[model samples]
Target: MAVSGVLGVFKDLDTAIAGVDALNELGYTRADFEVLTNAPYPEGTFGEEHGMHRLGLFPLVGAACGFSVGLLITGATQMAFPLVTGGKPLFSIPPMIIIMYEGTLLAAVIFTVIGLLFESRLPRLGSNLYDPRITAGYIGLLLHAPAEKVSEAAAALRRAGAEDVILEEQPAPAAAKAPQRKGASA
Candidate 1:
């Protein structure tokens, strides 16, 4: 099914909030629309509740995997080679500890990068409906819905005091394109 887009611009914070409420009254949930602004707003400003993410545990998991690999490598080398030096035992504890620590740190970083990419849905940015004026002061509300509901979404935004409502008619998917610079003449 094809999903159309509606971009609503509000004159102020109050109007934007009202527009969001109107959208909700019309049966649109948090997932159906999004609020876009230049500055960060407090959580739940538009009565939207986001799901909690479990990204923090990624580092711990990564560290554990790294530690195991390090232990296997160090222990195997000591058992197989049995190199003795400076009256020290064939199996040294200090060097093995250093190697294990480094491996653990490296794994943690690798896992964190993977987790961030997965959690953020990287490389899959959707067709965003926004106006260049959004950076000037207006608040933008992007609504995504089935093709049949485009009018209803626009109406809801209007009823809530949206200053402008635009229907996006972007072309079909293509190669990734860079965002247009604000002041560059094209």
Candidate 2:
């Protein structure tokens, strides 16, 4: 039982910010709304706008794990089969550093990509609320409002110079229901 409402698109960031500010004055907090921009904007551009919290930390932690594994493998091999070259020690520190560095970076990049995909909820066929026009240098402000307040929110957006207002419906779940059989006992 959730719904999303879309305000008219704005051609510039300034208009977007102004609309957000107006919404705030009307008692709409950051948690109840989101702004979609075609280009990156500075943090806090919309008077306390909050960005999505990232899950990038997973990749960094994974990289540390990889580095430790690499170091253990390299060191153990050298110890198991000691190679004596003149007066040099059987295990060397300089060569091991290089292997550890490469392994750590490789693992970090792999995990970061995986984390990005997981966080984004990707591979979806479609989204119910999307406007192709927003991709063409337009910014969209989406608000979550009670059913009774949708019109009021849309009016506020229009007053702040929204080009158009529209109601968006969430897509119905795609599960198929079994057909009921006539005269069949429960």
Candidate 3:
């Protein structure tokens, strides 16, 4: 893929807002850019759109699958081995309820954790455009556009009182690197 990214680092929030507006005027949409800040900023501070996530569905789907599996396991076990207790039915509902409840709880908890990780963008794949100054309370407006537009983005940022602008090309894919062997001779 073609390389394209311009990161504008600003000292104050107002400058960052101006930078965002500048990018917006340059025809960049909210999806084409993102704001990075160490401190919490209110939503729409940089006119960034609310990111969509399906965290809620994770637990519900997990619970449903867990409950189904629990029911199948319990029912199969009961049917496989006949248990005579007070002449009760072979597929007992009360006994199976406990296993189903436990399974549902366990899977829901696990899936919720997985959902959190997913929603949090854990185990990120690519080396993203970033600046260390953002961690030091600087706001960074990262704009991703075509290579042709990168210079314009950078100039827009510079005019918006950006402390500095960094243009970076995306690195090679991880698969391009040779695999290292353990305890191999140099």
**Residue-level lDDT tens digits of model 2 in 1-186:** 455455456677777777888788889898778676777777887665465666768678878977987899889988998987666788987778988888888888888888888886665333234445577888877777776677788888878877666665544234323211111110
Model 2 gets an lDDT of 0.69
Which residue pairs in candidate 2 have backbone atoms (N, alpha carbon, C) closer than 3 angstroms, thus clashing? none
Candidate 1, poorest ten consecutive residues by summed lDDT: 177-186
Count of clashes, each model: 0, 0, 0
Backbone clashes in model 3, listed as residue pairs: none
Candidate 2 scores a C-alpha RMSD against the true structure in Å of: 8.8
User: All candidates' lDDT scores?
Assistant: 0.79, 0.69, 0.78
lDDT by residue for model 1 over 1-186, one digit each (tens)?
778778888989999999888888889888888888888788888887765777888888999999988988998999899878678898887778988998899999999999998886655466645677778888988888887888888888888898888876653344334332111110
- Which candidate tops TM-score? 3
**lDDT, model 3, position 55:** 96
Better of 1 and 2 by lDDT: 1
Please list the residue runs of candidate 3 whose C-alpha ends up more than 4 Å from where it truly belongs after superposition: 116-120, 169-186
